[model samples]
Target: MKRKVVIAGGTGFIGQYFNDRLAKSGYEVHIISRLNNHIMWKDHHGIVAALDGADMLINLAGKSVNCRYTDKNKDEILKSRTETTKILSTAMLACENPPPLWINASTATIYRHAEDRPMTEAGGELGEGFSVDVGKAWEQAFFNFKLEGTRRVALRMAIVLGSGGGAIEPYQNMVRFGLGGKQGSGKQMFSWIHIEDLYRIVLFMRDHENLSGIFNASAPVPVSNSDMMASMRRAMNRKAGLPAAKWMLQMGAAALGTETELILKSRWVVPERLEQAGFKFQYETLDQALAEIVKS
Candidate 1:
């Protein structure tokens, strides 16, 4: 029988990408999402059945943090992540033959905003505020589960760049429109990973049974906002672009219905554990990743 994989909340950008990869890799892909067509989140029995005898279970369920942080949005953001995770844990517990590997989604935003140094799994400092708190709670919910039969890994993913629709499109458009000079001081570090590499890390973790717990799913190379914008401009063949100041960014963010923190936060995260585990990134540099993405 072909290997089976279950993806909770697998209807978004990352999930769609992974679904294609899994299908090509000959694994039977299953999705438990909020959508009514497939197995819904409220359908507990369906989820239990999907988890049984699966190779891996990747939970990427959560509300998007791209909106204004209203009280209602914040509450939904926190509950969406923790509640879905709790449900998955219960489903895992009910599985007669649970997936050998369960990789829950996490964010690099868990680490404090640092212009000082790169945040590693062993050395990173946890940040405060709503975003950081959400990351903490999400991880806590996953780690709260104790199962001897299955290995649990929390993938602290950085901003994922890919040919498919993701955060890259908006940034690309910014660069094309000549507003890509750099937001804020432009000195803040921008940590990111190719979506392909992010996918590969999941396979590496699943194959390497010794690996568990937290792993920073970012590239070894992290560039600054200025450098990234420069690369974007080069990729798009734009010579000069305008810069957005902190106050300007605030107005722009409000108008766009998004948060400036997504652009302003200095996420200097590195995939130390993944590298130490001998996992190599296909696109190690921003230019390399951007080149591939822009062409596609």
Candidate 2:
């Protein structure tokens, strides 16, 4: 009798990785997604049925925020996260035997753009405006419902680095094209986690029953933008990187149809709770994580 794990909106980048890890761990994995073969999100009956006998539920359903933050895109970004989470909450509350543990995806951007200090789960100062509002709203919707037996955890993840997908490839491409340099001031902090470690963190929360509430999912060692770009060059065997100024980033982001915030935001986050819980990170530092990813 293997434990069943249902992933709501589990067809995206992080979801796919989690799905693979869960399946390999011998959990009977079921995906409630938009795919025709899986349980569709709109299929109310199917959602309820999926939640009925689950041991765990991990929801990673949301639109990518890699593009330009137009008004329409902003609305969709907020709605996609909040609404999908709401639906899962609705379904979970209705279940007599709901998942004992429920983990939802969250962003580290909820914290203020701080260069002076690192943001932790306990004492981090939250930011304001569009991105911050979105993060706050997403978490708000997730914790709004109270299921009797369910222990809820929101994973406030930083930029997840890996070989197959995520922020690594684009940077690699930039390095290859000789455009890899520290963007803007190069003083902004960049916090990140290896994807493999991310997998372990999820399991850690699931296995540790007492662990509940928001946890920042970033590596302990965050580096400056210049240092990261230099490391990227070293990993790629490149000699020099052309630095991009603030104006250049603005123009480039506009031309590329993406938001500058993705590059400009100083995400100085640290996983204090996870470490304090005795969860060891395989790639705790940026260079080590990058080396492994570059080789892969």
Candidate 3:
């Protein structure tokens, strides 16, 4: 019998890519989304029925954290992640035959700002920002739940790189127009992972039952902000230098209800746990990842 997998946010960007990969890998894919109309799967259900009888459950349901974090936006951000996790946990507990593995999505911002040191899963301080607080609450909600038969894995992901919509496209456009430069002091660290690797890692974790805990889903080599911009410029073949000041980012992001911290904060994170598990990154260097994404 083909393995059956249920994806909660299968219609979204990352979820769609993951769903396609799983389908190609010979799994019976079932996608569940609030939106009834999805091209990936015809069988849709509310959160309640979505957790029924599956080998694995990958939860990617959450509002985009890149937006401005105003009071209203913050509420949406917190509720979107926490409430979704709660719903999924409740549903999983009620299932007659719950999935064996439940891979919940998380962010790397849970680590505190550490410019001089890299954050690892074993020993890293938690940041004190609103976003970090939200990440903690989101992870805690899942951790607190006691699903009798489901093994949980919380993935602390970094910025994902791909051809479609994301921070990369906007940065690429800026570099192409000769208006690209590092934001703020250009000293903060930017950890990232390619979409291909991210999708593969999710599948690997789902299949490996022993892999349960907080795994940082990021590339082994994390680059500084300045280095990242320089690489982007090299990829675009542009020599323009248009760096934005800290105040400018603050003013601009304020319109969207977010602060400048989203662009300025340092998250020097490394995938220590994943590496210990012998997961090799397909694109370890920024240039390699950028070239492939740009070409695609």
Give the number of the best model, judged by TM-score: 1
lDDT of 1 by residue, 194-292 (tens): 999999999998889999999999999999999999999999888899998999999989999999999999999998888899998999999999989
Candidate 3 per-residue lDDT over residues 17-42, each given as its tens digit: 88888899898887766675642222
- Give the worst 10-residue stretch by lDDT in candidate 3: 38-47
Candidate 3 deviant stretches above 4 angstroms: 38-50, 255-258
TM-score between model 2 and native: 0.97
Q: In model 1, state the lDDT of residue 73.
A: 98
Separate clash counts for every candidate: 1, 0, 5
Q: Which candidate is the best by lDDT?
A: 1
The residue ranges of model 2 lying beyond 4 angstroms of the native Cα positions read none
Better of 1 and 2 by TM-score: 1
TM-score against native, each model: 0.99, 0.97, 0.92
Please write out the lDDT profile of model 2 over residues 1-296, one tens digit for every residue: 88899998888777888889899989988899889999998987788888888988999888899888999999999999999998998888778788899999999999999999999999999999899999999999998776678999999999999888888887898889999899999999999999999989988988899999999999999999999999899888999978889999899889989989999999999999999999999998888988888972
